[model samples]
Target: MSRRGLLRTLGTGAATTLAAACGVPAAYVAPSDRSRSDLSATDKRLTWANWPLYIDTDDEDESRRPTLDAFEKRTGIEVTYTEEINDNDEFFGKVSPSLMNHQETGRDLMVISDWMCARFVRLGWVQEMDRSRQPNVTRYLDPQLRSPAFDPGRGYTVPWQSGITGIAYNRRTVGREIRHVSDLWADDLKGRVTLLSGLDEAFALLMQGNGVDITKWTADDFHTVCEQVEKLVRTDHIRRFTGNDYIKDLSSGDVLACQAYSGDVIQLQADDPDIEFVVPEEGAELWSESLMIPNLARHKANAETLVDYYYEPSVAAELAAWVNYVCPVPAAQDILASAKDEETAALAEDPLIFPDTAMRKRLAIARDITAKERTEFAKRWNAIAGL
Candidate 1:
């Protein structure tokens, strides 16, 4: 199953509802209380929570994650890794109580979508990582991903893997090339194109389609896209709203073109060469599911060490090979290029994995929907998409 297939359909509604009931001020943690005294000097272990199938797992024995095993071996820090995160809002609901109370979540590290990271950063529910200790990250992190609107300079989050939100189409089935977001609206694609259902997942690319600057898109810009999408839905121009199931539709030829993630397209192309993913001429949303250290994490220093270790070009290349997402470390491209395995070396040249200069020019990380905007935006979006 694709990673997104496991995501909950509710999006951020659950968390937003909880915040409304409890009141935002009551849940906010003061900055001084966000940290706890470090135990990393003596505690040689840390627990990490992440999404399923995210890390590099051994083919023969799925229990063994090569990169993680190497981290344990190289630095005597034993990691207790759990694939416990299934959805962004679901996971947020799971841990928000502890975070709101300023208590340890019993997790040293975790990964979630950057949009959710913005929520935690705003609530002061996560600790800022010390970059001085993360030399590889400081040197190799992609410049394009360095300063998202929520976490300027990436002070609180590190991208675990990145992907592009763009258009994916079966070229032969479509019988034409799709160069812009406008192409999906062509009369030929009526009742054949699908869109993402989740409010956070669907909005930016649609706004980008209208030539809006997603990084600083205004409320008027958001409502304009909503109006357009509502019209598409009413006229059956869109077959339906979808989650990751768009992959199934496209693969089965039910849909010819749809909004898709870059990583999923890579896997699809391996099976059917006709599958093509495009960063539209107007632009596409560059997004990431990022790593973060929650407030009062007991092994903060040990977790920081692990984060830096993965930033090393060689290590990043190995992880990138298996995960097939955009590598946050661009330096890893050279490492993959020099690998002995032919298939592995070819990955170094995949623009989806390491985007080319021209492609990079069109990629932008959208500004996160704020606490003030999420409820209103999600309500309008959910009503239209029927989520």
Candidate 2:
């Protein structure tokens, strides 16, 4: 069954039973439990770097996040949260030198897209978490995110929230229902479709269109899709490759269909009722931006505490409502379902936020490209993108 169908059939029930047995080890323990703390007074304050507009912000002020403030008040740990990360590759380039040298990133806990997190773990630039202090994580992380190809046991990272890379189209402009990946290549979409320029964002769905399993996809599978996209590009079937600017284009009717992230589509839907998102029948990539401790963080314990604090169902619910992304804590879905406001309550039923079992099955975390593969893949993708 398609991932969406799985969700319609299983709903919240599957997450209840499947979450525990996901990627986490039954007898697993974090290395932090055995390590000694070397933190000092200055380390009392930990720096946390995250993507822009990722967390819950005060509705009007935008400067305050009630949940984060409460965490600091209760724990007495100062958190310097900065929305400095604008793009994954840009952030990685900025911190690459420090990470390669094992120097402090000046960030105790940083949130990065999982694919990049895999690079950090592979480079040994992040710390392994202590599971003893993170019982909430061990018990509460959504089953789907438990064991990704990059971090099988998920010892190096934990998801902040998850989302889908799927198709987004303005229904009024397109005047048709787009229900599958093959629809993007239809003649009707010629010169009216945009795909993401970022290789990570664009590749998986294309692979799925060819009916390849992403979890264990091969290099040949990648090149095969690349050649197909090259053919489309040469024929001018694609409008252009883009960044987040695709949102602007879609909103303005300059583009009718494009690849999009689920979180961004939620924002678009608020103003334009015609904007629609769909998880293609062939499957879409289920990706996450995760939190991890940098190699030389001074407050690993405090960071661990903060990570666990967010796992509580109540905390997770508040965040899920604010960010409008897939919640990693299944228990939080029940919380939203009972919200007092109809608007908020409706979010609980949104399949994008808490995908039912069928949707969960269609969702797969694609393997990260190796550095060698990246060079070759980027060359091909950039050529098609006219970069």
TM-score top scorer: 1
Among residues 3 or more apart in sequence or in different chains, the pairs in candidate 1 whose N, CA or C atoms overlap within 3 Å are none
Give candidates' CA RMSD values in order: 2.1, 9.5
Lowest lDDT 10-mer window, candidate 1?
Answer: 6-15
Candidate 1 lDDT tens digits, 1-387: 666555543243554654454353437888899999999999899999998888999999999999999999999999999988877777887888799988899999999999999999998999999998899989999999999989999999999999999999999999889999999999989999999988888899999999999999999999999999999999999999888889899999999999999998999999999999999999999999999999999999999999999999999999999989999999999999999999999999999999999999999999999988877998899889886
lDDT of 1: 0.91
lDDT of each: 0.91, 0.81
- Model 2, global lDDT: 0.81
Tens-digit per-residue lDDT, 1-387, candidate 2 = 222222223333322332232222212223343223548344666789986667888988879988899999998888999877655555666676666554577778888889888777766667888899899999999988999988888998999989999999999989999988889888988998999876888999999989999988999999998888888888888899876778888999989999988877887899998999989889999998899987777788888889999998889999999888899998898999999999989999888899998888788889899756876787777777766
If candidate 2 were superposed on the true structure by all CA atoms, what would the RMSD be? 9.5
**What TM-score, over all chains together, does every model reach?**
0.96, 0.88
